[model samples]
Target: MKKNFTLIFTLLLCLFYIGGNAQTQFWSDTFEDAGAPSSGSRTASIDFSCGGPPFTSYFTRTLPTGIALQNGSYSLFQGSKIWAAEDIDKGPTCTNASISANQQVTWSGINIAGKTGLSFKGLLAASQLGGWQGLNFGAAEDFLIVEYRIDGGAWTKALAFYSNVPAASPASSNQLYLDTDGDLIGDGAGLTYAFTEYSANITGTGTTLDLRFNCFANASAAQELAVDNFRLFEAPPVVAPTVTTTAATGVGAVKATLGGNVTADGGASVTERGIVWATTANPTTANTKVTNGTGTGSFSAVISSLPAATLVHFRAYAINSSGTSYGSDLTFTTNAALSATTSQSNVFCNGGSNGTATVTASGGVTSYSYSWAPSGGTSATATGLTSGSYTVTITDSESTQITRNFTITQPTAISTATGSQTNVSCNGGTNGSASVSPSGGTPGYTYSWSPS
Candidate 1:
């Protein structure tokens, strides 16, 4: 009984191992080991005639120096070798000529079980020798077709290439040349190559896959297509970033400083991160925002031109290739501005000291203090002043003060003078005359004597 139990436990472990391997399945190939065809020789044509489905074909490898001008001189996607359809055909003679029959290369036995998608990358080109003026009459009839099959199903078109077409022509349109170069034969203007990336979504429960690349060419046109760095993998799921909005500080009547932190990037690089604020609740990017550059981590922003004593809502936001994410809402109120007013009374004339100044404070914080320029008490009102400019300063609990100036004018005074007259008879005696005058008042004055 113990032997049977041990055997069952060993089988369970094997099952767990297999399941883990399937979840992490991945495959890739650069075709660098596919030996190059003999000089001036091409592989046999492939027509999917292998009795069943999923037919494979031979691949031709070349070094960067071999096709540098036609294709870029860069090494293969992964190695120094690039794979493509054989360059020369094995028919009548071994020369640099076009193939008499169509040729194809294929990749098979791709296990995509439990996979989400696949991608392929390569470079392709079609050209003829002697420039664009040395091709046969029917050279425009050549083309290359790329197809794929799943679970031995029917082939589906993936990509296609054609020779004898202008470099600027659309892929779906066929370009025709009329031998305008006076060469009497068809030709092409050098070589045109482009790198391409293709992707497809994997559906169903398929476990195996196949891909084919077929090149059709005329008897006089030298056509070629190269593929390199072909890879297959499961697409990762998209996730949004995680961020947090901290409390605000440095609050003022018109500005405040806010802070935020990006805790996680959500499996992707953070492209945009910043803080957003609004006068209402639940702020978003539609409101006032400040960009704090890219990447994750902590950031701070100062919001300016805000209204005084206003309630503001703010939050942190981060964006990645997947989507934008926002942090929790934060609230803060701006400090109120100081508002104070003053009233004054002028002093009386003739050196009278009855001037007064009163200061009234509002808004801002309470617990105010008053100060006078000359010399006075801390009360809001200041009195006993002559005639001149007087200043009073009112300070709030926040240490913010407002100073105002007041003036008191001098008043007019009156004066009179008299001289005793000697009692003298009606005779013309100088000592018997009396004199009186008025001064120390307005220039224009009038007086009347009683008993005149």
Candidate 2:
């Protein structure tokens, strides 16, 4: 289970933000109890207008119901209440409300002492209801000006807002914000008068942070503004990404397929991921590696041109801003594509079973094993073979094998084709004729023909 950090900001409403990673939330405010100054929350106001109304307060916290916007009245963006500069009751003689001149309202001293990567956001709603059709949006400072500062340092301007008005302004440009959806009723009612969210990233750290909204007006026209639901966030700490090395597949003498999985990114983007291999165990990126791609998820690559009949070690890896991380080492062994050579001796003489078939295995693991066919031989050499066909199956230690087929042959013995002898036609005669023809065996018949 994951730990949760959230605060309920309102009585009837619950407001909070969930971090993308395991990030921490420093501070947040929904202004749930915003009311008259008598409420005494962490808020202050200042009035700087000519007879700034007949009121002692510069701002009033109330339910957001913007009536001046041409589109329609405003509603609370969140919770039940908001801090606004608009006046609820305008006196008979007062030409402007409490937010006439350089009036300001501040929500101060929100703690963020040791926070880094500070991000903040809030909701704002307003309209240029009365005059000055300006779209410059606080460019020259007219309506609500949102500013923030750290540890009471120099205030940094963030965003400004305006309201509904005529399309053209007689003096400076106004009506920077209006109901642009065309559903509202006003001269320049195109932009929405609804409350919208605005966010900004803040750098530097301090014990406390302050948010201030300054409302500037000519003390002649009526304007409305409200602020609500401000939140701050901090990014999660970064570490090396988590990755797992998968087992090698399709392993061969010189090639293999291997890959890995990026289970977690450790709060940072995985910029690089790949595989590394070497003859030794625990290989690293400094060794032979194939970079697959960027980001998370499963990826694979082929490692080729490896030595034959060797044991290789490989690992999967991933890279992020934090650093590099590797998976467990995986091992695979390659056999040398078994092959063999053979020498055979035919039957020494006809009708003799002394033929020999011998095989020399190579291209495989050392101490090779051999099997001969015809149910008589199991070693490298097969002996006592007649004139017949035979086969030998040579296997390596790694279960790789090769079969060699050979024939045990025999030679014909000497024989006579045709022969005749002149029978002693003239026995013991001085002119006795003898003739004979012989074939077979090795040519050149010898003259040891019996009765000499």
Candidate 3:
């Protein structure tokens, strides 16, 4: 009873496991709380725009001490808490919600004290939004930071810049750079600056993405940065896939054998690779049908029973973000069935004995038919065949045939003969002719007589 119960439990578990893996149809991303600032949690603190709310909250440190928010506006003064004495002029004014010459504000010391730099970053979940144009930071002079986070963890710096200078002047390029190779700040003089663009490849499960920015201040603090244009808009997604096949030996089956490899890349995998057959001599196509498994990188399937004259073909394909990629067709053929043969030793006879001939079939032949013709006569096994030339033809079940021919000669038997003289050849004079008779092998023959 216990054994039966255990078997039932195992079967149930297997069914449950298989049922849980529903095929994924459309891909999607889990929505994330994108409004948070570069630092603070409850209210996004990173000041996306140089002159906006939820702005300074995103900043860890700000320059020009006496910085304050009044009536939805910020005031910057040399003596203010967020300000420094080196600020060229005290409070710059934002009139009609527009930045004027004096309204320009820079956050210094952001990169100083070993604090993480500021950046502007963007995130797009595959499931959520589509048809995004591109991401834009403020003009070059704004000297903003752009950074991104994967699956919402720590903020990694993406790009950084210095003040493009002369606010309200023609725009210059943003400056962003790493410290040569290390993360630590290098010597203050001649430090490389640049505005960088970065891309992230997401794999597995998590979908939420995060971004932040740090605005650098002026030369006064040598520690500040600035921020501008903090917002999120969709950007085009990325696509690239790789396809490869496994190592294979030369096809050896009399009938074409099918085999293949696996595919990857472009966020896709192989569903099937098709194989087919053809019959034309040196045929590229024609009378073809899929012989192996379907779709994807690697798989194997027989083309069913094939004739010796068949030529087979193979092709592969994969589905990815960019649609399907097709592989070039390759072909191999079922080698023609061959017939092989071996010759039997020559037949030797002593007087009038009989002789026989024998031959063997090789290769793919299941059965063999043999016929022989001799210098003497034709026979199935060629028995009692007198000494003479002979030939044998063998046919295989496949109908392929081959022939061998040889010669046979018999040695003559020893001969014994006797001779007699007629009546009387008395006293040395030959009266009558002597006669001789021969028997065996040489038959009746000639003879000569001499008397002394």
Candidate 4:
């Protein structure tokens, strides 16, 4: 079998940063306690010009009974106390009191100076009386409007809703009606009283602002509008991407595969992601790095031509509009190259002994363990009788092994002898005889006598 000499090592580079960009809560109210200064109240009369701190007694409207100021089974409102307009307190002659009795709440002098943007989230639902039942009811006259004044400037209508408005009501550039069921009235008898989420982006700038929520019914009786979980937030700065590193895979002595994942892009988009590596700890983009591609998610890259048997640090990283982020640091070392040399001794003759072979290794960890095939013992040198093939295996400290082969051959032997000859007269024929001999070789050797 052919042997492959490639060695592989992997070091995981996890580069990461903690914390992230988050939105700041400028104000929030659950209206669990009507007595709390932050919790606003409802009035039965209309005073369009009345502006004061929330929950303060500044309005002159009679507090109606049907408009429950305490918490109840209303699924729309969060917590205990929800501001609801009901028909429980109607006088013997009262009907659709929300029209004749106006309810309004105000938050005054709110500071929102260098905020990027403003947003609000709340639950809102309107029940209709004397209109189409279920989600199809059309109570176009019932109104809920939100108005805001920046730095005490002229009040501008930010949002408005009319429960009975038709689905095709003319789209107003400044008004947004709640169409929870894609109908004019968001709630009806067929649909149990359930709250729906409402959100809007606050536009325009202000150092000290005033916000108002006003609701009233035009001609319908037994109608109610409930609001809860009101919150105002200041948009935070752009956020950085989140990233994590995966384990590295070694391809060979000098190459490995690095990987990572981008879990989030904070509210911005991720523009770049990949791996970075270096010889020291906490490798960053300033070190050697690879760009897998843009956007958030999993990515991988192959690193090559790395030094052998050296510790390396690496990590995954991602970049977004807010900034760059990295995973934790990881470490790995490459495999060392192995090399060996061998020497062999030949046997003196066929079936003779004294054959030996020795091996030496370099470029590997020290205190190496040695082994020889065919029972040559666990030593660098192997000595025994007869000539044949031999192999030596050496293992380094890291358990990496290298094997070398050597061959011992039989030595060739030679000897010669001159023939003894009787002295013969120059021309005496049969009286002269000569013989020759050879040894240390196969028999039947042929020899030629000199001057013959």
Candidate 5:
């Protein structure tokens, strides 16, 4: 019978194990290439007769809520084709597509059926950088935005800046970002996004041109910021960017020291501000934080309490006024715990000297302590045992300790001797005698007598 029961239990366990291996299900969508659409593939036919550079109206959905700039033949605003120094630079005169307050302009249009969006491209001179400062974008309080017109209806704001950002540096080097890996917003400096296509949702378009670059405090004068290759097209399926953990060492714990760089192309960042740890990739936003956002750009945390054998994964992120920018993920592991804990099942029994038992510990214990109480225990080197309640405590080399508790019960006493018997002959003939006794209690006894 016992063998049959064991076999049945094992078969049930096997069935449960097999059930756990069920595969997860998922689905995906595909789209035609924007670069070269094949037969039956939808492509925006653009006419450069208005100016140079062909326009591709692939992304036609309304832009996300942010600022935008337009150039090339698709520019909705007049005079956008010409590049002039006095039109969009810092100094008194703004020039080029880098709109400045001095040359402020607002363009508006309708989407009017068909996926006809907008597009533009140009170059910005490295010198024209406002350094860490940028020209005002859209309204001061609101994000700079690109609005689209669908079916000739009212315009709506599209595309806005995201949160993550890289440290601000002088515009000394040129950089490029494409939508291939992710959204093509320039790493930290610029960004790009697409809208849904084919839907009658979009008709015409317009853009707010207020964001421009101004010189930093230390500047000789104004420089040129250029822009070009702008267009709207059918939105495409976004690819998830790959995230990897890279650290100074594989050590789980990171030390507080001079700062280092963590990089990722498609927006990346460490989730929190304090020192945090995890064995998984892409930890949620709650795991870590270094300095609690003092704006010092330093990442540090305290984690001496964690076990040495455990591993830690970390990532860094930068938050711009708009949204979050993420960096690559990093990972490390600790040595292991200096000590561990063990527990014994709670025990209940009748009060008796034979109830005593010793718990054996495998790990070498440096100090053996004990505790005893009705329902609780304390830490002490040795504990004298009693009846009603008891507990044990043990401390290890790591200064960590564990406690266990048990209880003892006493049986009720029974009464014999009937009603009091009257004294027969003389003083107290055959005086009634009564006695009381407790089991598994103190070994001593005392008594008192009274006359009736």
Candidate 6:
């Protein structure tokens, strides 16, 4: 005969951790205060264990020996009830009086496909078993087994709660989970146990997540075992998220739009995502960065104040638990400011309209369209002439434009003199006047009258 609670430090309390990452809780159950079974099933076995079998009934319609209960009452963790397997001598409910043995309850069809960092949590408690003393046939060997499996894979142990047999129990300590170094728990100090929270992690992948809870108790002692409040969670992976960089779009003088798409979260949520750029071959967040925002998805940001006609290398990035991850290196050149120059011929005569102007445009978007204010000409080359200041708006395919002004001049004609005279209105009044108007040469006029 062996003492119970061989897994006190492991299955009962816990030794492994699920890390500090936050988890996504998906399901939970607090074993309602539902009425007890009308009759207990799963007869106790001559042996004991999670896989114990070939059970042989020692009693029929068994009830707890101590703690009087007329109708029996099942404890509740959430509503007013809990899943409990009372001691053999007494039934927790008035309905079921038979002691439970080699029995288990299962929850099936839980979908967990593509999910990672899975963890299971629950509550449990147990009373003293008689087997520790080696006094009678009912050595305390009853326990609880909680386990799960993915996509119908082999059932993996998530958590387990065993009968508390103590560490220093008698010669029957063989069943005390003795294999693993330092696995034995308790100092045989207390005879009873209290409720404690337990947790376990489920690593790997599967289509459906399934769970099972097993309880095995006998009628030999006044002890009992109970369970409540079961919970499951999916935590973010500890690895970096997967992301891809998109080519720069809307490249223009002084600014450009950069973006990326996050393909996978790497089992974790993306805390940040964005684009980084620099004139160098490989740019990092340290250079110039545009924060699109948090989370995984397609995002874009516009980097401004960039020098024109310059080549820049950039990359997209995402942040998560495992740190930062970047997309492939990408490069682009910003458009230079649009510009133009005009070559012209002065009007042949001072007031001639035959003067011509031709434009040679460079930089900015390709396709060009020219609009001349005075001539109303649409082509890059304008004719028909005019002796005056004119402005041509040079526009590119993207609606970007530039203005240039130039003057046309003709050599001053060999003084073509023309004069107008008015006879004196009043004979000696000196009111008569002589004037000359000049065209095409420098624009202003000057005259000198000799002795009126």
Q: Give me the candidate number with maximum lDDT.
A: 2
Q: Order the numbered candidates by lDDT, best leading.
A: 2, 6, 4, 1, 3, 5
Write candidate 3's Cα lDDT for 1-452 as tens digits: 33543454456446533643212112211112332233323222322223333332113224322232212222211111221111111113322222221222221112111111122222110100111111232332223344555455565554433322222221223222222332232111221211112222222223444444433322121222223223222222223334332322334324334544545544333333444334433222234545334334566553445555455554444445555443555666654454544433333533543555555556433466777764323333556655666788766554556777665555565344576767655887758665556554533445444542
Model 4 CA deviation exceeding 4 Å by range: 1-26, 32-104, 113-117, 131-142, 149-159, 163-196, 203-209, 216-226, 234-239, 337-452
Tens-digit lDDT track of model 5 for 271-359: 32333345677654565544334232444333344444655555654443334434466656554333334333222233333333244
Count of backbone clashes, every candidate in sequence: 6, 16, 65, 18, 91, 21
Per-residue CA lDDT of model 2 for 1-452, tens digit only, reads: 00111222231122324324444555667777533222213555542212333332225555544223333565446666666653422322344442234567776777776566777666776653445434433332345656778988998766554444434343433554533243222233222345566655777888877877776544334345567776667776788999999999877666778999999998789999999999999999999978999899999877777778889999999999999999999999976766778899988666888899998887654667878887446899999998789999887655666799989888777666566555455658665555557554335557665575
Instruction: Identify the runs in model 3 with alpha carbons over 4 angstroms from their true place.
Output: 1-144, 161-205, 216-407, 417-452
Please identify model 5 stretches exceeding 4 Å from their true place: 1-272, 284-291, 303-310, 322-328, 332-383, 393-402, 407-452
- Ranking according to TM-score, highest score first: 2, 4, 6, 1, 3, 5
Candidate 1 lands at a TM-score of 0.38
Better model by lDDT: candidate 1 vs candidate 3: 1
Q: Candidate 1: deviation at residue 374, Å?
A: 27
Q: At residue 308, what lDDT does model 6 achieve?
A: 74
**Residue range with the least summed lDDT across 10 consecutive positions in model 5:** 43-52
Worst 10 residues of 4 by lDDT: 8-17
Q: Which 10 successive residues of model 2 have the least lDDT summed? A: 1-10
Better of 4 and 6 by lDDT: 6
Q: Over the full model, what C-alpha lDDT does candidate 1 score relative to the true structure?
A: 0.57
Choose 1 or 6, whichever is better by lDDT: 6
Local error of candidate 6 at residue 135 (angstroms): 34
Error (Å) of candidate 5 at residue 297 is: 3.8
Query: Which is superior by lDDT, 2 or 5?
Result: 2
Go through the candidates in order and give the C-alpha RMSD of each one to the true structure: 16.1, 10.2, 18.5, 14.7, 23.7, 15.4
lDDT of 6 at 58: 25
